[model samples]
Target: MVERSHKPGPISATTASSLPQAQVNVSDDNSKVTATIPSGDTVEVLLYGATIISWKSNGTENFWVSDAAKLDGSKPVRGGVPVVFPVFGPPPKNHATSSLPQHGFARNSRWEYLGKSTSESASDDSVKMDFGLYSAGLSEEAKKAWPYDFGLVYSVTLTKGELSTILTVRNEGKEGFDFNVLLHTYLRIKDISTTTISGLLGTSYVDKVLDARESTESNSDLRITGETDRVYKSLAQDTTTVVENGSPRFDVVRKNFRDTVIWNPWTEKAKGMGDFEPKTGWREMLCVEVGSVAEWVRVEEGESWEAGQTIKSLV
Candidate 1:
């Protein structure tokens, strides 16, 4: 029931040239672009959604993708860091994207590979690339759902011990538009029950699991038990930490993104997802997304907005 994008052939030398001296490899099916670092860290990106399908540190994968994930672009891959734009969950009441998909057309549409770059500084050596989608490249269905000229540029950077993503949106139309966006990150964990998220204390959030009720987080550390879906708004801090078994795992930092979405399908909801591996998949992954979703961003003509998130390992 999902729409698929056209698959390209393997990346050629000319395509690899965009990355300069970095080690760039294309997927066998030519749907992905992978950049590897000398320190054994690597990042794989799918052109379909500019999705970060994999990120490995010291040969250990930090991201999770469902075993039953549709890499052929049939639907948005069920894992990794998916770029959500224009709208977050459902469309705002009577909004332009009301007729579009749940997260809008950005994740579902194919993006054009812009280029890649490598930066060397005193402390870090990183490889980064840009993938873009414009109103002209959007599908007819998407154009009809929200007819406005727009441009989106997504940048993925991989450093020695960190992965960063920056998303910038430009309004090219004659009028302004309002929208929401997020980085729907599915982080891999050793065990979901043993995981605890901190730094959201006193932050007000919308509890999606309990009929979208609003509540304040009084607990210093939040643990998962059942199906959990909450959107923490107007964070007092810019960073949050994820710990497992009393050991810090990773730190998530956000810039210009005011909200954080925490989700876990748990048991019953996980059973209904066809793209997710049924039995044990939910136990291996948790979603701790960061973005500007609680409120809408209004962009006027020829204006732009940028938001970013960086994930660093604490181990």
Candidate 2:
């Protein structure tokens, strides 16, 4: 059986003392588990509610998750993958009418560490860790919001050179439930301005920054420039995908998620990012998220849904 607990129990509590802590069990295939933070602390980044906080390594910080949240509680102590679910982006003005937390509480709330296993896919090779959150803990909030019992399971595995995430949502209530979700990932980059996303050519996307009002389809490969944010619609069913291209390009293969979000805070917004480093303009990183925002997933009672993304570094 897998050991389970909520919040960074004893280890996470001691991080304030700089004594080095152990929160969630670090596990690998063969059921082996360790209870200490791993080595290599050149720098640290955060994943807050599925948002990238910051990433620093070897004297250079490539990704910007958020610099401001370090003072607030929305930051993650662990420097790797953080899972987001149920909803993404800003909350609707009427959060009371919704059963979701601000970007859902999966990232902020502690998860029950399920266990570990080997990769089941042949193309990918790495260990996998399982984490889960239930609606039971949020029943009071749910009752006031939408009043439905549901369960969410998130799994993160460090494979080869990248982290992979699998999100599963189950409807445990008698009634149906519906909502949007996103894997709001902040990827580390050599340079954001020089990075280009291929494999999306001829694919159509709904430009969010251009206007949340229209669905603009794209057929050409995109290169990041300014504050560009767009939601793609009716995307191809194939899993072949790519995010960054240069000496090293990140290739992403997704399952079940049909929408893609491309975002970068180019000029003024980049400076305003709380946790973001100063003088790091559009040269930092990009946020290319795999999500389903415009579409609402409806899971029936006793039914469950799963979505995931596998990332590979071609660098």
Evaluated with TM-score, which candidate comes out highest?
A: 1
lDDT per residue as tens, model 2, 1-315: 766666454544433335433233433331223321222112222222332333232234434444333423344322233455566665576553354556665566545556666432335444555656777765365445656787877776554445567889999999887777777666767677667775565566767676675644454556777788877764675443434444446667777888777777777876775555554634665666787777778898999999888766554
lDDT of each: 0.89, 0.58
The ten-residue window of minimal lDDT in model 1 covers 13-22
Error of 1 at 97 (Å): 1.2
Residue-pair clashes, model 2: 12
Model 1 per-residue lDDT tens digits across residues 136-217 = 9998989999999999999999998899999999999999999999999999999998999999999999999899999999
TM-score, every prediction: 0.91, 0.72
Candidate 1, pairs of clashing residues: none
Relative to the true structure, candidate 1 reaches a TM of: 0.91
